[model samples]
Target: MADIFSPSRLGGTSQAVALASACLSILLVLYLMFFADLYRRPDATESQVAQTLEGRPPLDIHIEMMSLDPIRQTVEARLNFPERRADAAQAGGARVRLSDGGFVRELHLPADRAAGATSVEFGLDGSISAYPFDVYRTDALIAAFAGEGAQEAPLAVQLTVWERLPAWEARVVSRPARPGEVGLPISIEARRPPAHVVFALIVYAVMAVIAVCGLAIGVLAACGVRKIEAAFASSLAGMLFAAPMLRNAMPGAPPLGVAADAYVFLWVQVALMIGLVLFICAWARRGSPP
Candidate 1:
C-alpha cells in the first residue's frame, strides 16, 4: 500500500489515476456547459395574422416584457412591428387592457405611427399576488387594423408571471390554437432567475469549489505531497460546514425537502461527506499531522 504513494515506486500508476480524475472533471464541466440550461427563464410568444388584403403586406407583431418589479407588480414592455408599410396608418394602433382582479397604471404607447417597421415602449402595473408560487397572469387586449379593409385583429395571450427576484423557478403557460385558426401563437419568453434558483446555483458553486479542492488533494496525495494534502483536507472539512448555511441565507427560501433539496442539495451533501471521509483516510495513512 505504501508503494502506491511512494515517489520512486508505482509512481506511474498514481500519475495515471490523477490524470484520469482530471480528465473526468473536465468532461463533467463541459457536459454541464453544453446541456445544462440551468438558468433559462421562459417568456415571449408570437402569432401571425390570418387574413390579408389583396395588395397589402403581411403583418407580424412581437411583444416582450422585462425589468419586472415584484413589489409594484409591474413590467416594462415593448411592441414591435417588423413589417414596414408605405402608409403609417396601415401599421394600425394597439390598446392594453387587463383582466378582472388586475389593474394597469403608468401605461404609455403611441396609438398611431408613420410608415416602416416600428416599435412602441410601455409600462404595465398590475395587482398580482406572488406567494406560495402563485403566477400572476393578465391578458393585454391588442387591437390593430391592417390593409385597406381595416379588419379587426385581436389576440388572446397569457404569460407566466413570477417575482422579479433572482433564481426562482417560474411556470410558463402557453395556449396554441389548432389549424384553421387565425394563426398559431409563437412566444419568446424572457428568462429571470428567482431567489430559490439563485440559492441553488450558489450552493452548486460551493460544491464546485469543494470538488476542486478534492481534486487538488487527490493529485498531491498521489505524488506523495503529504503536507499539501493534509492542508487541503483540513480546508475541505471546514468548507463542508459552511455549505449548508447558504440555505439559511436564501431570501424567501422554499420549505425544506423540496425537489431541489431532495435531489440536488442532498446529493451534494452526500458527495461532500464521501469526499471528507476519503480525505480523512488518506491523511491518516500519511501517519503524522503536517
Candidate 2:
C-alpha cells in the first residue's frame, strides 16, 4: 500500500483508486437504498388485486409505505389515491390487514373478534395525516368547498398483504372470467416511488460534484505554498465541508448541524468518498519537491 501511494505509482494507483471508490460508493448506496428491506418486509406482497372495478376509474389505490416493529406492535402507513375529482368525490375508504392465519382482517384488530369486527382497528384505520390523498382544486365553487368542511375526501380502501417472514411477494390474484383459472393480471402494478426520488437523485449528484470539486481545489490551492502544515490544514478544512454528509452515512451518527434531504443520504456518501480520493491525489502532488 505504501508503494502504491508513491509518486512513481500515483498515476495508475489514482485511477485504480478512483474506479474502485466509484464502484464501492455506488454499491454501498444501492445496498442502503434498495437492498435492505428495512422499511418493508422482503418478498412481502406489494401488489393487490381486487375484483376489477373497471370503468376507466377516476382514481387508483396503492399502499404507500408499511413499517412493522413487532416488539412495539406498531405499524406505520401511507396509502395513495392517485387521482381525485375537482368535486368532493374521491376513491376508497378502508383497507384490510392479513394475519398469520391467512385470514383478511382490519389493521390493529382487537384480541376479541367481535370487538375488532365492529371497530376494525388494525394500525391507524384512516388516512395518514400530512399526506392526505385529496387534491384541492382552486376554481369557482369547487375551490370554495375546500374552505374547511369537505367531508368526502379521497382515500384508499384496498390493501395487498402477505406473511411478514415468507420469501414470497404477494400480488392481488383474482379469478378469471373463465371457469377455473386464478392469477394476477399483468395490468396490476405496485406503487411507484414518488417523483421526489428522481428529483433527489439529481440534486444529490449535482451537490456531490460541487463538493468534490471544492475539495480538489482546496488541496490544489494549498499545494501552491511550500508549507506542509498549511497544506494539511487546507485538506482538513476541505474534509470538514463534507462532514455533514459523512455523519449521515455513518450509522447512528447524529445529524451534523445541517439540514439535508433524507432521500439523498446515500449519494451524499458517494460524493464524500470520491472527494476524499481527489484530496489524496492532490496531497500527493503537493508532496513532490520542486
Candidate 3:
C-alpha cells in the first residue's frame, strides 16, 4: 500500500489527471465568462415592458436605468416613448409628471428617435454602510395628460433597470398603487454583483496576507532569529503608504469609514504599523551589520 502511494510511482498518472482536470476547469470558466452578464437580458427587459404596457395607458414613459453613483446616492436613467411618439405628437408631444411626495416635476419625452432620449436622475435613499453589499431603493409615479387639461405624464409605466450597470444589479418591483395614486409607483432595489463581492473578499485576503507577512518578518527580527536591514525597514515604511492605495483600488470604492475599512483596511494598517515598529526596535537593539 505504501509503495502504491509513493510519489515517484504515481507521478505519471497523477500529472496527466491533474492537467486534464485543470484544462476542463479553465474551459468551463471561459464558457461562463462569455455569456455571463451583470444585467438582465435586453429581451427580458423589453418583454416585461410589453407586459406592463398592456391595457394600462395610451402613453408610456419607458424609463431605463443607465448608471448608478453609489457614492453620490443617485441613479441616472433615460426616458423614451417610441411606440407612442406619433400619438404624443398628435396630442402636443408627450409630457409626463413625476411626483415624489410634495415635490413634482415635469418631463418631456421626445417621440422622435433622432431627438435623443431624455436623461433623468433619481436620488437613492439606501444606506451604503454595507458597501459592496449595499442595496438602494427608490420609486416614482407616472401619469399622462389628456384632453385639454395638459396633465402630467409618467406614461407607459414601463420601468427597466437592467442596463449599463457593469458593477451593480437592480430589480424593479411594482409598489402598491394607492387609490388616489396619480402615477405608476415603482420600487427599485440595486445591489452589487457577485463579482464585486468576490473581489471584496479577495481584497480582504490579500490585505491579510500582506499584514501577516509583514508581521512575520518583524517578529523574526524582534525575536533575534533574523537580521534587520535598513533597506528592509524602509520598504516596510513604504508599505504603510502603499496600503491606502490598495484600499482605494477597490471598484467604486466609497469614502472612508465603510464596513470594508473596518473589516480589513484598518486592521491591516495597524498590523503593518506594529510590524514596522517591531523591526525598528529590533534594529535599534541588535544593530544588524550594514
Candidate 4:
C-alpha cells in the first residue's frame, strides 16, 4: 500500500492535474476581474431643439445634472445659454419644468463669461429613480421666454444631458418636437457597475487562495508526500470553512445564489469535496486505523 502511494509510483500525473486545475482557476479569475461588470445598472441623458423659425437668432441651451443622491433624491443641475442669447433668456425668463412638479431654484451665473457661454446653476429636489442594483431615468422640460409669443421666432432651444455617475454602458435618445410641436423630448440611458470593482477582485483572490491550497493538498496526497491524515486536514480547512468565510467578507454582497456563488464558489467547493473523498478513500484502502 505504501509503495502504491509512493511519489515515484504516482509520477507525473499528479503534477499535471494540479497544474491544469491551477491554470483554469487563474483564467477564470482574470475573466471575472477584467470583463465581468456583473453589477452594472442602466441610466440616460438627452437634448433637443423644438419649434424654431428660419430667421430667428440661434439659441444654444446646455443642461447638466451631476452628483445625484439616491437617498435624498436630489441633484445639482446646470443650464447654460449662449452669451448672445443670455439677454433674451434673462428678459424672456428661463424656467425648468420637472416631470414631478418639484421645485428648482435658479442660481446666479458668474460675471466671468466664456467667449460664448452663459450659465445658470440650480438644485433639483424630488423623486430620483434609483432601483436596487442601480438603474435610473428622468424626464423634464425647460422653457425660456418672458412675455407673449415666447414660443415663436427667436425663441431657440437646445438641451444637453448626462448621467450623474460614471457608467459601464450608456444610451442617449433625442426627440425634437416637429415643425409646429410644443416641447422637446429627450431620453438618456446609462448603466453603472458595482461601486467598487476592487472588492469583487478581493473576494476572488480569497477563493483562489483556498482553491490553490486545496489543489496543492490533492497533489501532495497523490504523490504520497504524507499520509491521508494531512490530506483530510488540508481539505477541511481550505474548503469547508475558509472558502465560505472569505466569500462572506464582501461588503453588501448579494445573497448566496448570486452568479459568483453559482459559478465560482460552487465549482471550488465541488473540487474540494472530491479531494476530500479521494483522501478518505486512500486512507481506507490502506487499511489504516479509523
Would you list the C-alpha lDDT of every candidate in the order shown? 0.46, 0.37, 0.71, 0.52
What's the candidate order when arranged by decreasing TM-score? 3, 4, 1, 2
Q: Which of 3 and 4 is the better model by TM-score? A: 3
Error of 3 at 32 (Å): 11
Query: By TM-score, how accurate is candidate 1?
Result: 0.37
**Estimated TM-score for each candidate:** 0.37, 0.28, 0.72, 0.45
Residue-level lDDT of model 1, residues 1-290, one tens digit each, is 88667886667877889999999999789667644554463432342324234554333445444344444444455445443423223344433232222432322223364323233322333322333233334333332333223464433322223323233222223445345433223222223344444445666566667655655565556456655345666776776676677655655555566555664556656666666776676667774754
Candidate closest to the true structure, highest TM-score:
3
Which one is best on lDDT? 3
How many backbone overlaps does candidate 2 show?
8
In model 2, the Cα lDDT at residue 84 comes to: 39
Candidates 2 and 3 compared: the better one by lDDT is 3
Model 4 alpha-carbon miss at residue 171, Å: 5.0
| lDDT (tens digit, per residue) of candidate 3 on 1-290 | 99888898799779989999999999789658645753433432442432244544455456677888887787887876555444466445566776655357776545444245677777777777798788887775666654246453334554444443557777666778778886567766678876777677677778888889888878999998976677878888877888888778887788899987898889999999999999999999899465
Residues forming the 10-long window of minimal summed lDDT in candidate 4: 123-132
Model 4 per-residue lDDT tens digits across residues 1-290: 99878897687768888999999999899767655555343334463545354554434566665454444544445555556555354433433332323443332322245333334323333322222244445444444333335353324455555434442333435555435434444544443455444566667667866666676666566667766664465545558577788777664444576556666788778767766666665665663565
Residue 16 of model 2, lDDT score: 92
- Backbone collisions counted per model: 21, 8, 11, 10
